[model samples]
Target: MSEAFEQYERKYCELSANLSKKCTSASLLDGEQKKQKLSEIKSGIDEAESMIRKMDLEARSLQPNVKAVLLAKLREYKSDLNNLKSGIKQITSNSLNAAARDELLESGMADTMTVSADQRSRLMASTEKLNKSSDRIRQGRKAMLETEELGVSLLQDLHQQRQSLLHADDTLHGVDDNLGRSRRIMTNMSRRMNRNKCMIGSIIVVLIVAISLILYFKLSK
Candidate 1:
């Protein structure tokens, strides 16, 4: 709450209370004095209404939560002001009837300081309802926050899972490459072994043919 707004709201409440007192007390005066007091109260009522409007604008400028609370209060104040406005009109008209005016003043003066039992009960009920509404709004906000946090956590988990899958895929590809290289090395070793066996067979056949020729030549001698 801005200091200026609080100050002005206090000013408005004071102005309203003073106007109410003046309206009730206006009956105590004579014809000329009563007329003057009613006129002054009328002017004060107008000032009070203007203050309500200014406070409404101030409430709009507040943060969302604060504004909600202030606007609710401003509405209550408006209702009270409207009641005062209506009462003033009735007072103005009734002032011409001396007897009726006297009766109203007697009752109004006492009622100013006192609330009837029913009225107090209703006021308490309204306050309780307002508190319940506030609690529900707070609970809704908390739920939304919790849901948002859960969504963020899920997204993080999903991202980590995707990264792990990609790493596993890379590992599989590396193993496949190593297997292909080992297969090629085995093929080359097999071919070299076949060539060595063929060369050894050719040398043995040549030795056998040379030894047969030496034995035939010795028999001829």
Candidate 2:
């Protein structure tokens, strides 16, 4: 019975020592290992608490001499486990606060520059005005390009119309030359007809005079 109590006491002391070491070295562990170590520590704490309760009941049922020794060992075990738990709580709390501070520093939240509300408002208004000006400039450039395209199209149309007008003027000059040649041809034809008519009339008059001379001679004979 004494040997069993000694073994139980030694086992409890060994677990207490391991729990202390785990808590103290928690800061050196990486994220996943730290979490796993914490889980194991929590399980150890629960088992220790349960064992202390069982030992208390067992100690009460034992004889006075054995009960006294068992109670003393049980008290020591419970005290050591409680102290280990307190240390673990303090370490975890400190670690959490340190991590929070580091996160704030890394995100620039802790070292952010303070700006006055008036200055912020003025900056926003200036940005909006710049955007509006840029939009207007873009629209103006687009309108100018469209005007240039329309001017080019108008110039091209004027050039085409001028070419058509030039071609029409050339055609009209050719028609005028043809009309003048036709008029001269008609004038020459009329002059030739008048000369033929005068020649025929002269011949008829000569024949009539000759015939009258002949008729007079015959009558006298």
Candidate 3:
């Protein structure tokens, strides 16, 4: 009976140690997974920041208010992402240690229970933060997309307006040139008509004078 009790105790200890190690490893895996998720969220935020920067530059060169709004949005997203990062760090660092593991393990199969509970709590908190970050990033992306579309439409409208104005200007200039040419031709014709009238008046005056003198001579004879 004594020997049997000793064997049972040894087996239980061995099982406890194995279970505790497995739980620790599981916790470690959960931490790594959360880190990966955090990295993915950070990547998304970075991409959004880059897009916002590009939009801002375009808006600066093309539109003022648009640039300002986009820049402001970028700042807001960056701040939110920083908060998410802080939360992730806190959750990941609350890891269970060896003493806690051994005590929980020896407490009759509660080792797995305690470790699982801790892992679940940490995972849940980190996952929630990561999800929130993702949601914000998605929202930001959507807003940027809308902004880009609006910008493109505005640019197209401006281009069309410029083209129309240029065309109208060219037509007006052509008409003005034509009117100037017509005015010059009319002026030249008027000057020629005045000279011809003067010449005809001089010839008529000389003929009248000659006829009157002939009549006078005949009468005197």
Q: Is candidate 1 or candidate 3 better by lDDT?
A: 1
The local distance difference test score of each candidate is: 0.69, 0.64, 0.56
lDDT of 2 at 119: 33
Q: Candidate 2: worst 10 consecutive residues by lDDT?
A: 111-120
lDDT: worst 10-residue window of model 3: 1-10
Ranking by lDDT: 1, 2, 3
Best by lDDT, which number? 1
lDDT of 3 by residue, 19-54 (tens): 223323333454456456545544544554454445
Best by TM-score: 3
Quote the lDDT for 76 in model 3: 51
Q: For model 2, what is the alpha-carbon lDDT of residue 150?
A: 64
Kindly report which residue pairs in candidate 3 clash with one another: none
Model 2, range 95-174, lDDT digits (tens) per residue? Answer: 56546755776787664243234334534443454344334434544554465466557667978999999999999999
**Candidate 3 displacement at residue 106 in angstroms:** 11
Per-model C-alpha RMSD: 14.6, 40.6, 18.1
What is the C-alpha lDDT profile of model 1 across 114-147, one tens digit per residue?
3344334534443454344434434544554465
